[model samples]
Target: MDLRAGLSQQQSLKLSMTQELSQAIALLQYSAIELVDFLENKALENPLLHIKSRKAEVYQPKAKGQSQKSNDKAWIEQISDQRFTLADHLFPQIQDMKMSPFQKRVVTHYIYHLDDNGYFTGNLQDIANHFNFSLADAEECLAILQRVEPAGIGARTLRECLLLQLNRQEVKNELAERIVSEHFSMFAEKKWKQLSKLLSIDIKEIQQVFDYILTLNPKPGAAFHYERASYVIPDVMVVQEGDQFVVRLFDHILPKIQFNKDYFASLNSYQDKKVNDFLNEKQQDYHWIIRSLEQRQKTILNVTGKIVDKQQAYFEKGPTFLKPMTMKEISEELGIHESTVSRAVREKYVQTPFGTVELKSFFTNAIESVSDESLSSSKVKMAMEKLIKEENKQKPLSDLDIVQLLKENDGIVVSRRTVAKYRDQLGIPSSSKRKRYD
Candidate 1:
């Protein structure tokens, strides 16, 4: 072998990520609202681009009698939020109470220190040092805070929270009080046999106590800090026309773009070199953006149409008929990259005959079965949920029992661990926790 400094010629092919190409990729991934926002921002930079607003539909309210006016909002809905937090709700109650100024100040301090779960997280020693009061006085202030309307507000632990709620009951449950007071650890851990032996009471009574405890609020302040409801706007809709389903973009919700022809033509014919170059650059940018947006819409429509075609059974019969399909399979069928398909479906939704469903839900991993075609994990979960719903509460099915039942009833083969995982995903408890003695 000889080593020498020389230039070698090689022929190779590689994709160059030009600026316009990158923009096209980003446009494909953005949701409908995000695309509108992006275009609005770009219009400020490009003088040749202009965005046209679509007409919005307003819902009109029906006429009501004078007596019913108080029960109904007139026509418009409130958009501004003035939600109150836990601290705001508690401050006024103690402000008007008959208590010493220092005591009210201490309670106010603790109220501001309570966590979202209504737990008083401040240490007694810390409160005493801050307020120049004894630890016992601090504790008394905390007790007052706990005795407010939301019974469990200042509790430091779940056991204490339960006890606080129980104390406020009109007719107290003595057994429940004792269990939560003493054997809370055992009861929560579901050591029913040990609890039965230790308390010298029927396990059935323990079951009753468990049911009663579920009725209490664990996070008492959570209601005051509740989140506002969020609404989802779908990007596309699949409608059945005759026997074929057609995919249509929600064009009404989209912001349309029109070229500023007069603005561009006026700026043109300037003799100065810099002004001509600037106008030319802006026009190119505007055209690139328009093309990118067109490509984005076309890609999304093609991807969604393919998904609707493949998931025809699901559209016709419902989610129970969703087959095992993957993004790779869709990419192959459409002759596009897997990442492109993934980006097209990311955070995107389509309205169908069933309802507005997320695009990602149509792609589920395959679950093993004896049949030639495997079942989707979603379908198997549906079957598992059905079995659990009709299960005998006296001996709720264990993970192994669920596995056997799935194979016997649904012809789906999965391991015990998989069944346990699916059960946890469904938010169902284990056999011991789900058992009922009544």
Candidate 2:
């Protein structure tokens, strides 16, 4: 109960993280590309470090009908003609339309405001103010822009986008137009029973109309973008080797870093203590970085190897077989801290037989089945998708029906609510929306 401060010798053991250790921990989280960039920068800064550049393997083209020069010429021509973009697509159409110069200017301004999805994201009032024109004039320009090939273009809301498309159809869908205009909230929420009562139409008919709505392009400008397809570079590759899967780190892709022996040897003969101390500090930093990088690689290999082992079924049978896994489970199995496992997998990609997938995607929450076996949420989602795809269109299954089907067929007993959650996750609508009238 004594509160007075007293001088006393105390003995205790505590762990403290050094700056080098902190840097090592941070390096573990960096992706393959990031690590390469980091090493390249470090090599430039440190005089004692040298990164060996990979020798470009000379391409030995096989004897074919066309020469390599001809192939190069054709590739150059192909790239030159591939500069078409959303703006390029719309500008020609704008040029063809017969309008006053002022009208054309207004239309062009509206076009500039259109988002990647072809929706007009800017305020009409803002456009009006910029042009020093009435809001009505801006609206008129937007209306004319909506008349472009993509009917949903220049729409502010999803309701407007659908209605615009429906209006432009040669044979208009009156039911879809009404649903989008009036019951958009209900349509979005998939309140099929309420919609049925409100429209006084059969649930089946509403679903048929919904199916038509699905056919219309939601993101009209997505395909017209000039953006090149991005490719993922996987840090690790998992190859099936007979009964076991082999996890190999892509070390060849990264530049090999080593100490410059000549530079290190020359630094030892320097007379200036300050300069020598600075060089020594740099050398120590270089050594720590190299060690950290090696440790990072080992941690990654161990974590990914364990992950591949746990998700072996996923590699063999596809995404449906993705078993329930967690960082804690992996940490316990690998004899590492949960945070260490997390950092090792963060922003990392692993190339499998199927495709390149993020390492973090391997860990998913478990859902208990009736058989007392755990199912990954991803697995349940796949099961839900399969059921929806194979269900009778004329009488689409409800969430409750899916719950029962999973229990009966897959031996997975999930709640109706859980089925609904999984269904939503798959971007699937309700039973009423999925039903086919004809």
Candidate 2 collision pairs: none
> Per-residue lDDT for 346-429 in model 1, tens only?
989999999999998899999999777889999999999999999999999999999998998888999999999988999999
Q: Best-fitting candidate, measured by TM-score?
A: 1
- Against the true structure, what is each candidate's TM-score? 0.88, 0.85
Range of the 10 consecutive residues with the lowest summed lDDT in candidate 1: 70-79
lDDT of each: 0.89, 0.85
Cα error, residue 227 of model 1, in Å, equals 3.2
Give candidates' CA RMSD values in order. Answer: 3.5, 3.5
Put down candidate 2 lDDT per residue, 1-438, tens digits, no spaces.
999998989899998998877888889998877887888888878888899877656554656786778767655543544666778889889889888899999888888888888989889898799889899988888888888877788899888988888998899888888998999999877787789998899977877887899898888887776666777878899998898889999776688887888987887778989888978898899889878888988999999989887887899989878889999999999899999998998888898998999999999998878787799988788888899899998789999899998889888878988888878888898887676666
